[model samples]
Target chain A: MRYLTHKLIAFLIALMLAPVMLAPSWAQTPTLNIDVNVGIREPVPFAVPIFIAENNGAQAVATEISRVIASDLISTGLFREIPAAAHISGVSDFNAPVQFADWRAINAQALIIGAVSTSGGQLTVKFRLFDVFAQAPMGDGIQFTGTEEGWRRIAHKVADTVYSRLTGEAGYFDSKVVFVSETGPKGDRRKRLAVMDHDGASLSFLTEDNAIVQSPRFSPNNREILYTSYESGQPRVVLMDIFTLQKRDFGDLQGMSFAPRFSPDGTRVVLSISNGSNTDIYAIDLRSGARTQLTSGPAIDTAPSFSPDGTQIVFESDRSGSQQIYVMSANGGEAKRISFGDGRYGTPVWSPRGDMIAFTKILGGQFHIGIMRTDGSNEKLLTRSFLDEGPTWSPNGRVLMFFRETPGADGAPQIYAVDISGRNLRMVNTPSFASDPAWSGLLQ
Target chain B: MRQLSKAAALAALLITAACSNTGGLFGGNGDGTDVNGLNGGPIDESSIAYFQQTIGDTVLFQVDQHTLTPEAIAILNQQAAWLNANPTATVLIEGHADEQGTRDYNTALGGRRANAVSAYLVSQGVADNRIQIISYGKERPLAVCSSETCWSQNRRAVTIVTSGPGV
Candidate 1:
């Protein structure tokens, strides 16, 4: 998905230093599973030492990378970092044998050993995971080579490797998030499109704040973004090359387009189109620029999301008298209403795992971020506040990122993340007020 | 980060809006009151301010409802009359919503409200060519409070007088 204009200096060539790591073993780690009742369980203690720097200029970034890796695991709430001060021994060499007794003395269940080297403008990172309790390496070690500026990505990649190895699920650490950055008071707010690392690192502004923007969604490949822009003085859907920041109107510009999302294959985009009155879902072929109207009704339908398989789409519509979630074939037909027994439901995002749907629900005047099955059963409300909407699933489908706004003159919207179990709610940092967060899939 | 838009330009017209006060009556508090007794731009019946203040340029709607109320219809009726009298004045209708609802649905709801108002103005003999509409949804709020006191005023469609052609 990288465009020609996106001259990425960093190229991560993952080297299989220890060939046994090639096959991921799910049976080795049985301690970490998101499905388990996390409330009753204690966090597994893990330790990551300062990564060894193989050459000059690698020392500072090495320590920073290891710190980020530790931060990533700790933020999940499922893993606890045993501070470096608590460690009995420090790893000074990449190939040195781990002294399990020293780590076990500090009650460290898991250990991360990593090394970094810089040469010819290429930064190389290598890491291995160990189960201190089991007294053995959990898997073989692996290494990655990239440009120096890509150190953060490399660090996240290392974190992802460690997380997936321990959790038996793919890691979301190396992903990007697209959201709207807001400034000014409520009466005269200026919103701009923005992107950042999943951990809120490396913030970048994609557009000037002259126009209002909302609900930016990442394409499956993470190279493009589809969002609604008021730059034309009317709401229109614009597709932008994330690398170049070049944008073009999407679909037929005759009517207003907004709430756009890409299909799993990335060949088509589904979005809501309004002709100054009624709004409906429509799909456009990216290569051909041909548009297909998916819904025909007077009911207001806007938020549209594609299932991971690309065979079904889930969206919110007031067709049933109130805003609710509905699912239909990707080709479009009679959509079966999946959300029931709610104050109202909208912004229904299908999880990448394809088992559940996350949504924004309002009842009793209190807004909530909720999740339910694709068949619309087992609805679980995760977070409740004055206002919470627009839930975007993490790459692993274990967490959701949404926005919550406060009341009064000084009130503004900020992004928040919550787990599916309704535990561990934390605000994602941004330069200013940000909302309508869209989480991207794991980056290449 | 603090860029202003057209709605900010129309701040002079919202003196009597429901939520906040402009400190005092229009032209009396600030902006240099006319000492010669004859003001320019704002006081004329056909002027943007007169149409904005006297004829009433904004129509309010209820929560989650885009269907025009009797009160909204009355305002649109007056707007149509004002537009017909000033043939050279084209109108830009901005539709807005409160922060009570989600973003996307509110946007479409705002659109429906603006369209309903435009349709009413057109039915009353206001030329369709003289009307243009934009939905700000819940993005732009006139009032800062989160209660119904502010919400009611925020959910509105305003008619701004522009010169020449439609926006």
Candidate 2:
């Protein structure tokens, strides 16, 4: 269920943060303001004190939400948290005046304080950001209300606001990833579709372990998931309702269909169907089931992702005699080759920002997760490993999540995330081996 | 001499009856094992297990290449001959790829390999309607290691035979 937005909360105060010019001290870093962005500077230090509970009922949840917010901010590898234990001053009251000297002495560039209350079985959380150097509130205070069961999401929303205000971009903490969870030996591994928070919380399996599910992609709305399942003894694109867990398949076709992805509008799904030795991309209107063949050639064409505006689609095609990234009209037409690198490229996903295309590159027996400009310039490999493929963009397009498999019999695949700048590469937590991650849009 | 000839014909009749009804009972051959080979029981030249074990059922490919190699062609030739001989069996070609590629591309690559095998078998007189194929992609690797040693084995098309109604 969609959590209640902050507007629905009985708010005494809620204000949006304005994007403003950063104070020179923080902006003085060489790459902070540069558009080319090869920045590898020290992480911005921020402080998050325990949110003050307006009543005894919200005491425990307040602390937990604040902690999650801190964790969320720290996870980006962009911000260094000034731990609560080190704070010399606390905001006991929601409207308490801040002591700037105390925060300035700790060298924190920013500070955040919040308060939570319970009313009519609904929990309301309000938070404010402070620019410690300027000694003024960075943004007007904002609050959100939802059921206690949704406290984590509420916390994520708060973190999202803080992150956006500080970084001058959209936040991705409120997103989710749907991936394939694997178990058992490599020969006969059990795979199922699983969904979880971007930070790896609230994981739930969408399909049974016995079914071999592959390449799950989230709808633009985050209400449905499109995945390929071998339940019918052939890979077929299956649509599943995220809430009800009900599924409907495309039924048996002349050939197996796999690697399905939703258009940005969520109105159609594009997938690869193999007819004999040739695989081509086809778009099916979700409402009409009208199948349109986007690419019709004797080559492999799959891993189709749409531009954020839903005007065009970027997919991989080997029509050039080797796998390469290509772009074509969403309505099916000529596709121009975009990848000119010295390797085979596949699994091309257009960034949500529509600026770059992330893809899996194979060269000299090494697998890499890389991105290039939409026009195929300035290609940069973000990661190189024995196996690294299927990069999915975070909501803001600043980070990517992909799977990496280690070498050896004891090795297995795990989910990993990295910023576009090629820093903060960390493994995401999962109960078992996971791969083929598809990130959902930020939750409404 | 006429009486001896009559006794020989009667013995031949008894032996033929035993072979038909009791699977050569009392013939000293002791070939009474089940021929259908249900539950992996006794199997002979016509059994599915014979097709799997004796005739060979897998064809491997090189990295990122689905074009059948000479060794792969030899295996497929054997498989085609087996399928031609055992027309009552159905084939399900399971295509697989190594973990060296992306999921979607590898899946399509697996399909190419399986289709290559199927096209070869059909060309060699195997019925098209009796064969079905599925690409497991890199999802199911024969060997767990990430090295070429395991990848070579992983990139293969395995022909699965099942008992079907007689042609």
Candidate 3:
């Protein structure tokens, strides 16, 4: 009888263990169902007050740093910057002891402070982040030294440091954004290649032309750009040195080349090549110009992007009768349709993190910014507007930059950025209209 | 007069056919292919209106800038003449960017292209209310064959005349 009881007890224990062990396997099996993405709500709030100057005449620099930091943080839609007027404690000095009680009164969970000094033409800046509730510095303070012309950069570095410490993601501040610059009327529009600091400072035009250029993508090293230009009159992919402004076109191709992007290693370029009426995505070695075609179909395939690991590519194709995003092996295998929703997806840009791909989706005549997993799961639409396209990620993947066109009394496009959380949608000001924002990785 | 109209219509038809072939004036096929190879669709009325008004001419810009060229100013001056004559006409300045930059920059380039024209027309006594600008960026092309000839043709802004409301 005792042996019988032991067997029954053993059976009960095994039954409990079976469900626990089998749960993950059941979850892993593939199934077909429409997965609607309900997005995150109520982003965390933090306070970014102007860092106190270590000396006199540093107030302007301090103020500018604080303002830019606030803008960067608030723009991500993850952190809400506390208004200076609402602050219970005024920060008077960078080294001054913090009054945690005052910050807690205003419900600030995290705080940032910094100090700037100038000596020998190089600006030395120090900053600290704190967890107010824990009453401890979030991380050790760091210092930066650079020319006065790089003050904005110092601010960006500070913002990046704070962002990384808080979110555990890479920082995109201190990066450069390269795009086409324009002037003139519609039929007579003049375009020049241009680069600017990611925050929209230090603008420089790279090309002089009616030489048409399109889709300039920065190398992973951030030293070069691969773009398509009409300099020779036919559409061809060209490589340009960012520092020297020297450019060279890729060799002898039968068809037109456009939508050029770099592999994560920057060794090969993925672009769409058109021969007569046929268009397909091809990978070409930057040095040898040896080419490999990834797709061969009657339909057009363009906008090829390499997944972070360089193992697969996500691109836009009209293979299914309308534009949609597709995933395929990096070496050109059978392509799988990943976007199975109601809208058309274009410009599928694989995220730097390798986990999600960002894209522009058009549905019901409205353009939206959206993200989905690498395999096309968990698709989340981040922003919707009258017109929004060309999404590029901040180095940390927290923010996206794209152009927003509000039909002016006269129809012209305006540039705008929205956080991935679908908040903090605001215009990114330019002297003229801006679009096709390609965010650079953080300048190391 | 009938011959003149037929010749004008034939010229208009040819120009429309060319513009539609480039895929710049109306919505692009949205496939981001060579604009020159886009011979898939018919030449619609909008392309005809765009061509007859400009007669295959587009605005011009100076080197490395989207600011209107003197030729563009003259075109707008002429456009002001045509719009004043047709009081019911509303103009949509479709913007184009040269193929030389990134797509986003080209979109902005296209906008600046439109803005330069819109601003000039406003100064030339065209009601800002009657003019609208839409930047198609490098998505539309007047030339699809890879060549400087095609690129130059692609880098243009064309003024499209629409009958305001109820037309």
Please list the residue runs of candidate 1 whose C-alpha ends up more than 4 Å from where it truly belongs after superposition: A1-40, B1-43, B164-167
lDDT of 3 by residue, B1-167 (tens): 21332454576566646756567666666665322323545433234344344433378664225667677777778777666656666766766765443353355456657767777777877887797665566666565543456666667777766443213
- The DockQ of each candidate is 0.50, 0.35, 0.03
**Arrange candidates by DockQ, highest first: which order?**
1, 2, 3
The residue-by-residue lDDT of candidate 2 on A48-160, one tens digit each, is: 88999999999999999998999998888888899877888878987778898999889878888888887666788888888888777775677687777677788888899
Looking at model 3, residue A112 earns an lDDT score of 86
**Model number with the top TM-score:** 1
lDDT of 1 by residue, B1-167 (tens): 11222543454434333112322333344544421113222344555555665667888988888888888887777888878888887877888899988888888988888888888999999889888888888888888887999999999998877663221
Winner on DockQ between 1 and 3 is 1
Best by lDDT: 1
State interface RMSD in Å for all models: 3.1, 11.3, 14.5
For model 2, what is the alpha-carbon lDDT of residue A418?
A: 90
- lDDT score for candidate 3 against the true structure: 0.69
The TM-score, computed over Cα atoms with residue i paired to residue i, of candidate 3 is 0.66
| Number of the candidate with higher TM-score, 2 or 3 | 2
- Report the number of clashing residue pairs per model: 0, 0, 33
